[model samples]
Structures are given as structure tokens and as C-alpha cells.
Target chain A: MKRVEFFVAVLILAVCAGALWLSRPVAAAEPPNTPRAASDSNDGALFTAFVPVLRHPRCMNCHSKGDYPRQGDDSHRHTMDIRRGPAGFGVTAAKCSTCHQDHNLGNVHLPPGAPAWHLPSPSMPMIWEGLTDAQLCQSLKDPKQNQGRNLDQLVEHLTEDKLVAWGWNPGPGRTPVPIPHDEFSAKVKVWQAAGAPCPSR
Target chain B: MIGFSVNGKRVDLDVDPSTPLLWVIREQLSLTGTKYGCGMAQCGACTVHINGEAVRSCVAPVSRAEGKSITTIEGLSPDLSHPLQRAWLEEDVPQCGYCQSGQLMSAAVLLREKPAPTDEDIDEAMTGNICRCGTYPRIRRAIHRAAEMVAKGGAR
Candidate 1:
């Protein structure tokens, strides 16, 4: 009976060791020219950096739940009765690009622009109206939801994408994003280098 | 300087405080209903009640509202059960609703001052509130409907 009890104790010890090993956090592999840190790869810090940009009025207005984009910081419905078209452009004759140009036209109070001025396609609306930070980070990491982009592609999108860069240069009468685009891109790089882990909701 | 009761809270502030009171209310106090449209005050999108009179908020400096009772849309009724709101719902006077808050505020003042306002009275009072959707006819109708509702003691 004593021998049997000793064997059971040994078995439990081995199981505990295995569980601890498996539960240990894994570090993300760093890319070329990227800084390496164990905590940087963790999902929480990365998500914290990403949330502010997502919540900005410029980002939230077009990515709203309703068909119409809101105006001003107040998030009121669009004044001109504009509706998102079937293609996520404007309605029949009023394509968004008509007023929203390939680039910002320097109008202080009008729609600030980028080459891709319209909302995300209806097929992939990428709704950002009221998403929590965790949900947004998780959604962004998922290729199926992120317009088929992997972590590396997402990094490139943030660093090099024209629309993403617009936050820093949003025309007059608008509050520019709190963080500089270059710093934001560096944060994205750190996150991707850290295995693109999403925080647990 | 001006002293006024805003949203039932009395306060005093300097006039020409950089931006308009619409921006001040939205950016400072976070009361965002009064929109900024045609900042030159031609659009009437920033109407607020000043001592039972409809005044354009975009152009009405803090000095002008001093020592007066100023009310915004949020103060119309805590639950939006104001007569103008009921009339608006009955008539569906909003298309985009960006301009409705100002419109409702203006109509509320008109009804209070001229309980039995005519088309002419409404036109004269409502001239400042501009509806970009061209819902003028509907707005006119709702104001009259609200007047009738008030007469029957059904409006609050």
C-alpha cells in the first residue's frame, strides 16, 4: 500500500510539471530591424496602443454601425442624407470620391481624405463603431476578418498604408491623433514581433 | 462677460471665448447636440432658447446670453417628452436628424411664446432653423400639430 501511494505522488508531480511547461508564455520571433522584448509580444500592451486610433472620430465615423457616416466629433448622423452604397461608396450618383478626393483637398472642415476614401466594402464592413479594445485586436489578428492579411501584412498596412497615415495629417479643424504615426508603426512592429498574440477578452 | 442659466445651471463666462458656444458646450461640457454648420450662423443649426426666445447659438456670444435663462435641447425635457419632440415623432420630421435638435429647440420657444401660433408666426420664428433635407413642410406641419396638442392639454 505504501509503494502504491508513492507511485501516485510521482505521477501527480510529473503532471504538474507538464502543465506548467505548457502554460508558460511563448515569446514572439522578432523581425529584422525590430526590437525584442518578452512583454512587447504580449497581447495586452499591443492592444492598448491600437485602441486610441480605432476610437478616433475619423476612424469611427466611417466605420459606424449605421449606413450613414457621422460628422464632427459629436458623432451625429451625416447632415446631407448620404447613405453607404451597395459597394460601400456613396449612393447611385454621389460616389464618395466625388467630394472626398484621392487625397485631402485641404478643406479645413470637410471630409478629410486618402486614396481609398470610402468605407470598407459592405462584404467586409470592418465595423469599428463601438468595439472594445480586446475584440478589435482579436478581430484585426484574424485573417478571415482582417481582409485576408496576416500579422506581417498588418504591420505593413499600418506603417505604409496611406489611409492609416492620414490620422497624423487629418486636415485643419480636426484633432490629429495623439500618437505620431511613426511611433504607432513601431508599436505595431513590436506587437507583430511578439507573435501577434491577442489579449484574452 | 455674460451670466445665464444654461440647462438650468447658472453660470458666467467671457464673451468671444475663441470658438462659438456650440463648440464650447460640445468640447467643454460635452453637450454635443447643437451642431456646427455654416459657422457664420446662416444655417440656423445652432438654435438655443435664451429667456423664452430662440437665439442662434453659433453667433450668440456668451455676453449676449448673460443674465438670461439659456436652454439647450438636453434641457427641453430629460426624457425628450417635450411637446415639440412628440410632434416631431408624430410627423417624423427628421431625415438625418443632424438638424432636428436645433429645430426642436426653436419650435419649443415658438409654442411657449405664441401658444396659438399661425403659419406666419411659425415661418417667422422658424426661419433661422435650416433643415438641409428640405423637411420644411413637415416641420411646419409638426409645429401646428404640437400647437393643437398643447391646446387639448395633451402636450407637456
Candidate 2:
């Protein structure tokens, strides 16, 4: 009975040793601290960089849910009987191109223009008017709400779309988006690379 | 070069496309009846007909007039014989006469669309055109008179 017990103990010791050896390579292959830990620190700051640009009147003017797009930094209702036609362009005779051209007019107080100048279509107004930073972040990341764009496409649109770029060069007398386009683009990429994490607040 | 007809006259010019149709009509074509009250299109003093649609020419780029027929206030009548024009004179619609051309042009479209326009239709159509002289009441009366003439088949 003593000899049988010794054999059993030896077998158990061998099994334990085999399990440790098998796990050794996996432990070495993994990073010292997961990339998630390092990126968690930066994701919030990276996304925060986008807040000011998104909240600026230039961006918010057409992003609201109102049937008519707002104008000026004051965010007043657009005059001229403009209504968001089935599409974002104004209704009937008050179409956006009726005043706004492909480029800004030479003088101040005139309609600032861009290609496809319009508000978000009524079906998906993509309203950011009253959203908190956290809500904005979540809505932006949600494909269902963001015009069916994934993270990379969202980055491309916010960074490269001509209409979006108009926020930076919003004609004469208008204050532009807070961050420079290049820096904003970089921050967006960083946020994307970090898995597009949402902030708590 | 952009090509379009202004008041039944074919015009093909090499002006910058971004030039406002108001400038093209007033300066280039030498039709000055359409006054420029507000360049921002807020006030409809520069109203004109683009293919029979009343569009504010001050904010409408000439490119928008490309391939379209443009009718300025000058084209409304040869000798001020249009129904709206006669009605304007009959009702003394012009106080300052600055916004009259735009008012007449806008009224013409409204009359065409609604031969017998109520006060509400006139108000809805002519609201964009502003007359600083406070001649709205007179303008409304003139539109009703013009509508009556059209309904009677008295004027083309």
C-alpha cells in the first residue's frame, strides 16, 4: 500500500510539471502589460480632443434635429423661410444652392458655401445639440446612429469630408472649429487605434 | 462662357460663373430695374424669374441661370402693359418704388399660380420681398386687382 501511494504521488507531480511547462510560452508571448492598459490612459484624452470641434457652432449648426438649419455662432434659426426639405437642402425655392454656392461669397455677411451644403437629412438628423460629451461619444461610435459608418469610415468622414472641412474655413466673419484640422485628424486616428473607447462623462 | 436667355433675348457671356445673376442683369445686360436691396437674399428686392420661378438674383450665382431662361423686371412688359404693372399703377403700389420691381415680379408668379389669390397666398408669396416704405397694404390690393384682370381674360 505504501509503494502504491508513492507511485500515485509521483504521477501527480509529473502532471503539475507538464502543465507549467505548457503555459510558459504563452506567458512570454503576452505583453508585460496588455496594450489595452496603455491605451486606456490615452483613449479618453484622444476622444476629448474631438469634443470642441464637434461642439463648435460650425459643426452644430447643421447637426441639430431642427427642420431648419441654424446660422452664425449664436445658433439662431435660419431666416428666408428655409425648411429642411425631404433631403437636408431647403424646401422649394429656398434650396441651399439658391444662396450658397460652391465657394464662400467674396464679402462678409453673405452665405458661406461648400459642396453639397446642407443639414443632415431629417431621417437621421444626427442631433448633437443637447448631448453631453459622453453621449456624443457613444452616439458617434454607434454605427446604427452614425449613418452606418464604422470607426475607420467615421474617422475618414470627420477628417476628410469637404463639408466637414468647411468648419475650419467657415467664410469671413465666422469663427472656425476650435482645433486645427491636422491635429484633429491625428487625435481621431489615435482614438481609433486605441479601439475608439468612450469616455465616462 | 455661360448661355441663357434674359427676357427672351439669348445671352452668352464669358463673365465669372460666381458673379451674382443680379450683377449680370443690372451691369452686364444693362437691365437695372431689379434693385439690389439686400445682397444676402434675405430681402427679395433683387427678385427675378428663372424659368418662371421667382428666385432672388442677388444671391443666385449666374451659373444657376446657365441653360435656364431668366426674366428680369424689364421683361415683365414692353410698355408696362402687364396686368400686375397696370394694377400697380391703379392701386398706387409704389411708395419709394425701390422694391416695386421685385414685388411685381413676385406677384406675377403668385398670380400665375393662383389666378385669384387670397390675402394669405399673397402674403406667403410676397413675404420675402421687403418694401421699407411700408407699402404692403397697397401691394396686397394691387395683387388682388391683377388677379381679377387675369380671371376676366383681360391681360396675358
Candidate 3:
């Protein structure tokens, strides 16, 4: 009877240990992308490092706060005097793809083009301008605001979206995001591994 | 070989598929009424109709436009008598006249959608087109007058 009791106690301890192991940092995490539900990791610093990239004109120009998008490094109001029409693209007459072709043209100062170039659709504006780091982080994690994406989807988008990739190579005469593409993506992953924490501010 | 219908006429052209339709319309076909303002989609100056919807042809690729029916300012009327055109003249809606073609093209779509467009509808429809002269009030009046003409029988 004592032997059976001892065995049962051993089983309970083994189960507890297994659970604790599953709960540790991602270094031991299987499947690689496992994000902790919560942690004390320097999530604030990771996210703060990403803030400037978000604020960069290549990213922020499309994520405008107002109905119309801002333009250039100076963030001047779009000289075309256009607005975000029924869709984020311009109205019936001047759709976004009209000038922004699938790829950039040779004219350095002319329009910057990319595949399917246009602002976020009206349904998912994803406006990042004027958002506090905490709000921005929360917005990214929130499925409603982040195009119904969970953490995995967000990571995938940051890593692979063609339009987002435009930041690294923003055509001629455009200052791109400061961070290298791989580094930026790596930073995002590190932040995710840090349990995707947010800044208090 | 690329083929598209312009103003109800089938046009066949030998050109790079990636070339912009605006250049085709202006340079190759020699239909120059559609003006290029910013050469970006922001200005409605290059606005034209594609399958009854307004589209800026400035950056629209010739390949994507293949097999689609295109309408330009020239297609609006042979006689310069489309109701919107007549109303534009009646309201004196131009100052420098660079953006007038795009304005008329955009306004045509609005009148079709909302025959009796209110100020709000006008604002929404015509917002894409810009006149450096700041002739918005006149454009609004022209749209109203054009709507009235359409309701009467077909804007003449």
C-alpha cells in the first residue's frame, strides 16, 4: 500500500514538472513560434525599437489618420487634393492602382509603384499614426483591428507581405525604413518570443 | 498584340503590355483629351470610363485594360453636347481648364448613380477631381444643372 502511494505521489510530481517545463521560455519551446501568454520579457523595449519603423514615412504614409493620405518625407498633405473615397483608394475616376503600377517606373521622382499598391481597404484602415506604443501594440494583438489575425498571422504579415516589404526597397528618391529587413523581422520575432508584451505608456 | 475597345471602336495595337493606357490614348491613338495632371492616381485629371466606371488611365497598364471597353472625354460626345458638357459650359466650371475633362468624366458617373444628387453626393463623387483655380462651387452647380438636364430627358 505504501509502495502504491509513493508511486502515485511520483506521478503527480512528474505531471507538475511537465507542466512547468511547457511553461518556460521559448528556448525549450517546440514548433518554434510558441508565444507565451504573458511574461516579464523586455517586450516594451522590443516594441519601442519597432516604433520608429512604424512611424517611418514608407509605412506611415499609407496608415494616415485623416481621410486622405500624407505624402513624402516631410509628411506633406497629398498635393493631388484627393481623399480616401468609398474605398481607401481614390474615387471611381482615380483608383489607387491607376498610377501606382505593379512595379515602380524608371522615373525617380514619379509615383512609387508596387504590386496591388493602395492604402489599406476601408474595412481595415489599420491607422498607426498618433498611436501610443501601448495602443499600437494592443492594436496589433487585437484581432478586430489586426484584420482578424492572431499572433502567428501578424508575424507572418510582418515577415512576408509584399507591400510591407516595400519599406526595405522604397524605389528611387525615397528614404526607406532604417532597420534592415531581416533585422526588423528578427526583432519582431524576438518581441513575440518575449510573450508579445506591451509598454506601460 | 493588345486589343481594347475605345469609344465603341475595337483597337488593336502592337506595344508593350506594361505600357500605360494613358500614353496609348494620348500618344499612340492620338486621343489627347484625357490630360495627365500628377501622373499619379491622386489627381482625377486622367480620369476616364472603363466599363461604365471611372478609372484613371494615367498608370493603368495596357495589359490589364486589354479586352476592356474604354471611354475617354472624346467618347462623351462627338458634338460636345453631353448633358454634363452643356451644364459645364452653362455653369462656367473652368478657369485654367486643365482638369475639366476629368471633372466631366467623374461627374458623368455621379449623375448615372444618383440622377438627383444632393450636395453630399456631389461632394462624394467629384472629390477626386481637383481644379487649381478652386472652382469647386461652379463644379457643384454644374453637376446639379447636369442632373436636372438628365432628369428632363438625357443631358443634351
Best DockQ goes to which candidate? 3
lDDT of 1 at B3: 62
**lDDT per residue, candidate 2, A1-201, as tens digits?**
999999999999999999887776422333323334434744467578778999999999888767778988998987655677677775433456656777787778888988989887787778998887778998998887888899778988998999999999998999999988977876677677666777777
DockQ comparisons of all candidates to the true complex: 0.02, 0.22, 0.27
TM-score-sorted candidate list, best first: 3, 2, 1
lDDT of 2 by residue, B35-59 (tens): 9997887788898988988888998
| Alpha-carbon runs more than 4 Å astray in model 1 | A1-43, B1-156
Determine the backbone clash count of candidate 3.
1
Going through the candidates in the order shown, the clash numbers are: 2, 0, 1
Instruction: Tell me how far the alpha carbon of residue A169 in candidate 3 is from the true structure, in angstroms, after superposition.
Output: 2.3
Candidate 1 per-residue lDDT over residues B1-156, each given as its tens digit: 556688999776654643455766777667888888776445667777667666556654455455778788888988978878888999988999988888887788668767888886677566656787999999999999989998999977
For each candidate in turn, the TM-score is 0.47, 0.70, 0.77
In model 1, pairs of residues that clash are B3-B66, B3-B67
Top-down lDDT ranking: 2, 3, 1
User: Recovered native contacts in candidate 2, as a fraction?
Assistant: 0.24
- Ranking 1 against 2 by DockQ, winner: 2
